[model samples]
Target: MNARDPQLPLQPDEASQIGAFAQAMWDEHIVPELTHYIAIPAKSPMFDADWEKNGHIDTVLRRAAQWVEQQKVAGLTLEVIRAPGRTPVIFFEIPATKAGSTDTVLLYGHLDKQPEFSGWRSDLGPWTPKYEDGKLYGRGGADDGYAVYAALTAILALDRQGIPRPRCVGLIETCEESGSFDLPLYIEQLGKRLGNVSLVVCLDSGAGDYDRLWLTTSLRGNVTGTLKVEVLTEGIHSGDNSGVAPSSFRIMRQLLDRLEDAKSGHLLPTDFHCEIPPERVVQAQTTADILGEEVYKRMPWACGGDGGPVLPVTTDPLQVLLNRTWRPTLSVTGVDGMPSISNAGNVLRPFTAFKLSLRLPPLVDGNEAALKLKALLEDNAPYNARVSFVPDGRAGAYGATGWNTPDIAPWLSGALESASQTHFGTPVGYIGQGGTIPLMGMLQKGFPKAQMMVCGVLGPKSNAHGPNEFLHVPYGKRLTAAVAQVIAAHP
Candidate 1:
């Protein structure tokens, strides 16, 4: 982890000659540029109203493309591609050196980050990049920003070594945080300009605690909605309706109890169905062995004493991974139509509503899940009370990454193992990602023949999209070099 250590990797000779040079450039220039990249709060869609006015997305593209341009990559053309009303697309191309070897590899990344939420140990801020204790504290630093830098550094390193760099293309979007609504438009408008792509590298995902190159097999789909009930025309004083009127609160309780069993968090319906891939189970077992207790500590919260059946907290790692990536889960996100305790009215509210969010298994049919959930709530609601369930936004899950492509498995595995040795204390291990990246699926549709490789610097306890997000800097620098090495060796 020491920055001064020269014994790190790719011994002075076997080391990527070009990568060594790019390493100097990355440390002096790219790393500093990322500090500015992290400082901009260009939250996509969540803070879209501010985004257009702030024009922060444009600032990010400028910095990213400018950094790429400074590399002095030969035959590489960098351009800011934009269509009417859409975010800027940063494109860079390196033409083919040989006739049959002119295959294009597309690199993908996003500039917009998630909204920075409050509450942290005062050390982590989304807009502030600080290198402390060997980690880089900032937003979008690891989740993907590094991927952008790494991809460019990778191709340029090969170009510097006098190696025949593959025909390359780059795509950096500003709205990936908002499910990439403008992505289809960008691809459609520049479909031909993207050139003949043979491979893709998504630098948005994460690694295991030991720095394993994580390959996601699948991401769970999600559907969220609200369930409401009305028991009376108006609120009556609780003191006055003590024994006479049926409280809406009581009815809502009954309806929800029928929907979710408090004793067990499992959903009662058979609406969700997905057979887990055997490779995933084996991978989970490998993760359990690699992460061990740190996996348990990294979850949201856990019960300290390991209490009774109706325990207040839970912390099981293998089960946790299973619950997150493969199984279906539902949670009551928020409650509506309820007054604050400070209001202190003796009145019993006449209506109540609760927000419901569900994470579904792959291929579970989003519309089917929606209809099944609607029927479950409507049929289970208390009679004589007006009850309704309405579904809001729903996003389908992506399939597991395709690993059968030629050269991908060997190229990635070698880079990861080398990086782990040079960075962490042990070898690499694989794990599945819980969140969905829609671009992964969309790219598959546009170029079915291209190979996809996903890797990043986030690991266990390196929270993203939550309070106090950070990227491991020393590890990231090494990982960037690892990516450069991979691209250098790619056939």
Candidate 2:
């Protein structure tokens, strides 16, 4: 009878406090803030070598810190600590009472955005945050910029209710779009200071679509390399070499073709085998039923290309999720060595290269995968033309044994469920997000004892990182309340 209840059911006033706070803030306060934020193209130095000189990065950090400081959450203070050459990380903390009574939750997010790639519809650029059809569209909005607001919105909402809270620390990273190159150093620098975190909530990624809130159980490791095909020592005029030049680009495609099955989009090499675990298979099936045809339709594809529904995003949500979270998959992210249109010439380029990004499953030894991939690509090169691989980057994938999950999941599930009943229509569905957040791996290593929750407002069609990327304004506003409900009911 003396045991504390597993959940602290919210009083009506408490529930109102949560919802009203988010709704009010988002409608008037949050959107404007995100609008101004999305306008700053603070590309990561990892992606833009001259980011500092561009000055947009500094502007972004300052604006984010300023917006956070304005939140008036009692006892909450924001700090920006930066090592000499490294990017800045924003830290904010609402100190808790009775030190050990409520656990400390370390909240993480990022402020940087990806470079704007081509293919944006006119007026739908990365810097333009547009509102249309129940969504906020912009580059940084979903990928991570929204997390800054989402984290603070949740933290502030709980405080507005006067509920005693876990010591929530907001860890805002700057290089997330670029593989978190500076995270380890930040973690090391913050060393003992980041000690005693009880739970980690990474607000970077989100559910597959918009029906549910997802938990990331694992992230696929990544190996990025450039495959270069050198067909000849010198360029030859297309008129003279039309038949004999042997296009380097053509050769590159042929090599790539051998790596994957053209029909089903499956990787052919046995070197990248990963089976969807049975439990996850069940998760996928459940998700498939919930998602139905909408899942495939949500994907952005070329015009007249499967414009209608095709196969369920993955017949297995778990398998689909696994391919994203755990398995190794080859994606040719970029191609180079071809001349541009403005300088069009009828000459065969001497060389061509394709940038490849390979996702590695859990326990697939990152180094081993890199080596295996290098060998595979080299061997697959067609016509014995000179070929070489340029190592871009490599990192290990991460998987946390959800051991403490069983203990903490009830609180998370219930909190979100309660909020969903009020805001979303149903209980928050548990799902997985595919994408590499290296800091999650570092945090998992740094705080093995801390149970983590990774939730956010980014949806599938949000098109983060690509052109026309945007955040769903009202949805994010409501998510703040959802986070608050969970925190208030944390047992």
Candidate 3:
């Protein structure tokens, strides 16, 4: 898309008015709908194995579609598209006011949520929405059920102000939390419907802070699976096996040692590593200067809480950002074959099993990394004991290469700055997200010429996919206005 100097559509007074309208929309419409939405246990397909049979997915999709239709924006169309054995896609569209304008803006989000994790405060539950201190606590609201509402509100705000905007499409899928397994099918079937697009806006990312708008320029993909090691046929008395055989847990540690340094938390494999782009490094330094202590303070560090006090690996904010977004890391998410402490006895476990999760840099191929990891961990087992590395899933990484930056970057930057200063009293910030949204990579590949923007309200301590996940109400409103500004300035 060619860049043109699009004048600021909203003056100071007009921006104030739009901000108020956006806030009102959130308080009166978005929050109420979100409360109802949070009540549905609409877990993703991975978590809810019987999602289709339980009918929760269908129920929530219908509810969301009904609400969007009720908005009744002029020239708006909403469709619920379904393919065999795949989750539904809610396709929403608004025609551009300028006749014959073919420029399309694709806005993306998801309704399916991560499983209801444990450890919520006594009063907060995953399915129960709570509003307090300007924060709405729930599972899917921020991580993002508010996406469809926010996207449409932006266009609606522009239309209300009589600002010319490009044709807009809002695509909300139901399988994102499960790694977007079904999105490709819908994209294939609806390719024609999504014509040549000027820009793609994804509202399913992270924000470094609430004081300003944060844009995600990169995302680390992941490979997940189980690693198992067996040394003995059955559990034996510790007294008998203590000196006779190697502990299975020890064997498991040896296997993992081949992949990562236990003390330094560094991935040992060279293929899993990548060089961080210079632009991203500069962005990280600028962001660090803007947020020094807040970088780690914003986390849910235990002030003697139940999770216990924890320290960041490093005090330097720049390194923290780089380590999270531009580096490879490994985590042990779950384990099996170990008895509970209460039921445990003095015995040598027959086998040790662990769920392995690895985060690869944006430039690494998840499939290739997984293959290398399997070889590194499963081969040459200590004592020739039985070992297995079964990779259950892999999603490749994504990077917003310099070429993805459209000519309209300056205009979009101005819009973000205006919106942030008007509502947040701070300048906008740019940062990369540490988590994965595999769809970004897919879209980037399919529309290599399209400009992309990634922004979301999953800010500090929002705890998406964890206990007490929440959406900041005020930030949500301001974000809606920011989106409106971008749409209004698109040329």
Candidate 4:
């Protein structure tokens, strides 16, 4: 009956209470605030060129801080710390009443979101929250916005049952979508205020299923930049320039060919790839088996008009998983100098530019990858037309392949399983997310000994950063209870 027992999972009554509390918190508080949050258009600093001027980032931050303060958790200390010229961080501390507890658990999340992408459902948009089928549909809800709320709610759930936990710190940043460029400074400034961390729980990751808790063990890094190609000083009539002037768009495509296979989507440059660890391959195979067709089916294949029914490069689920999580890939996210179809004229454009986003393997050196990409693209410029490849916002990959899963994961795995079974009648799942959270790599370096548990509600069909983005309300509630159980049993 001891609430402090480290060897036990939560009892049925305790789990039920936690779940109910989490549900109520989501329904009554988080969902409402999240709706307002979605409305703010709090794009990351990179996307919001006039972020400070627009005041949307500040507005969302203040709103979040206000909501956290209103929670009125006993012994809670909340602060909005601002380093000049950086997005503000929302820091919260919840004290533990355990007799001799000294360790602190750092829970990480972000408030800044990706820019509003095109192609939302007619009934849904990025900034408008819609409640449907137990999902809170909005841009940031599932991707993040729920982290601090969930973290605090979990603690409150435990407190309601008088269960003891490690002291908790909720560190929510506002620049994750922009590769978390500002986080290192905040971590350094906080110094000892962050305390001796024994566990780092991150809620900004992907889930394998809505029916189970998924733990992310690895994250790919990001290398992003712009590639520009110029052919002429000004546009000319297509008939006059036909077959004479090289199309800048065509030159751009040729430059991209130096990096990736035009047909297979493979990174042609050997330097862009790294040796995939055997353990990761094994883990991927097992996870693929667990997910089966859910691996691909979960995606909203033709959401709106953005993408079609594209077949994966491989039919083997394991290969697809490994390709996504442990390989290098390139995406041309945005383009410039291309006229809209509606505005198109019979003119050959003078220049073309593209935003290149490359996802790196977990152990690959992102800086090196960027340098190599720049060299490859700039080396043999097609037509020797003015070409430039500028690299920006490089984040090194995070790999825990050689590192042992800390003592805390087993306890959390058990908690996740029990919670999942109770809530969804399914076993918990483990995955390595293809997306990057630079904070994990930063925290790993800062807290070398800290046990890490990365979980999230961004399961398939959540479509984060895309149209119809949503938070699975039920799974979120279950995840909240699972977090409470882990904290209750943390050694």
Model 3 Cα lDDT, one tens digit per residue, 1-491 = 21322354567776776788899899999999999999899999878989999988898889889988998888888999998888999998888875457889999988999888789999999999999999999889998999988988888787776666788998999988777778878888889788777788889987888888777778887777889999889999999778788998999988888888889899888888889889889989999999898888787776554566678788899999999888888888889999999999999999999988788888887677777788888888999999998876434421111112333367677877777787788988888777888778778788887777888999989999999999999999999888887777676
List, residue by residue over 1-491, the lDDT tens digit for candidate 2: 11323344677777777888888888787778888888888898757888877888888889889988887877778889888777889988777632345467788889888888888888787888787876777788777887877788887776655665667788898977766766777788777666588678787767765654555555566666788999888888989887887888888778777778766767788766666556655665676677765555677655654574344436544455556655556778887887679887988899998888777665455556667777777874677898887655434422211111223456566666777777676666666555667776677667776777777777767777676777776667667777777666666
lDDT scores in order: 0.68, 0.71, 0.83, 0.81
Give me the candidate number with maximum lDDT: 3
Model 4: lDDT to the true structure: 0.81
Q: List the residue pairs that clash in candidate 2.
A: 136-471, 137-470, 138-469, 138-470, 284-317, 284-318, 326-361
Q: After the best TM-score superposition of candidate 4, give how far the Cα of residue 216 lies from its true spot, in angstroms.
A: 0.8
TM-scores vs. true structure, each candidate:
0.80, 0.87, 0.92, 0.93
lDDT of 1 at 122: 78
Instruction: Identify the runs in model 4 with alpha carbons over 4 angstroms from their true place.
Output: 1-9, 302-309, 394-409
The predicted structure with the larger lDDT, 3 or 4, is: 3
Which pairs clash inside model 3?
A: none
> How accurate locally is residue 78 in candidate 1, as Cα lDDT from 0 to 100?
83
- Rank all candidate structures by their TM-score, best first, as comma-separated numbers: 4, 3, 2, 1
Clash numbers, per candidate:
1, 7, 0, 0
**Model 1 lDDT on a 0 to 1 scale:** 0.68
lDDT of 4 by residue, 62-127 (tens): 888888888887789999999988888999998875767899999988899888898888988888
Candidate 4: minimum summed lDDT over ten consecutive residues — where? 397-406
